[model samples]
Target: MTYATPPRRTLTALTMTTLLAGGLLLGQTAAAPDASAAGGKKVVCEVDKMRQQSHSLRARAARLQRLGATAEARKARAQADALDRRVRACVDADGNAPKPWN
Candidate 1:
């Protein structure tokens, strides 16, 4: 028995898929360095901002406590704690906080 050839459309589709996959891989590798640089800067800046906010929240909690606003103080402290956790998670691989250039 003779083996039948693959249909034309199937071969075309397979070729197109392979080309598209290759193009995507090439594009990603080509852009990766620049993307990481830009994204790293942005992440550092954002984490810095979050750290500042968390600090301010803790201060606010302290002030509220002084004013005898126990409930509000608790809330502020909780928010600050949550922000601290998120900042920790976003810290660099070396476990250092991101230092923004600016």
Candidate 2:
């Protein structure tokens, strides 16, 4: 019995698939460092801004509490908490500590 060779179309398809996969991997590796650096910087800046906003919100909440606007104070506090959580998530995603605000 003789073994049958693969059709030309089948061989062409396999070769194209291999080349496409290799090109994708190479493109990703080449782009990774620049993308990460830009992304990291953006995350750090965002986290810092969120931290500042959170602090302002907390102060506003305290002032509202002093003036007997308990409902407003609570709302402000909740906003501050959400901002804090957002900052934490950004820091975690960035994989580094954010720079101190100047």
Local distance difference test, each candidate: 0.86, 0.85
Instruction: Give residue 71's error in model 1 in angstroms.
Output: 0.7
- Measured on C-alpha atoms, candidate 1 has an lDDT of 0.86
How would you encode candidate 2's per-residue C-alpha lDDT over 4-102 as one tens digit per residue? 567977898899999999999999998766645555664344777788899999999999999999999999999999988877777676776566872
Considering only N, C-alpha and C atoms within 3 Å, which residue pairs clash in candidate 2?
Answer: none
**Number of clashes in every candidate structure?**
0, 0
- The local lDDT score (0 to 100) that residue 59 gets in candidate 2 is 98
RMSD of 1: 8.0
Clashing pairs in 1: none
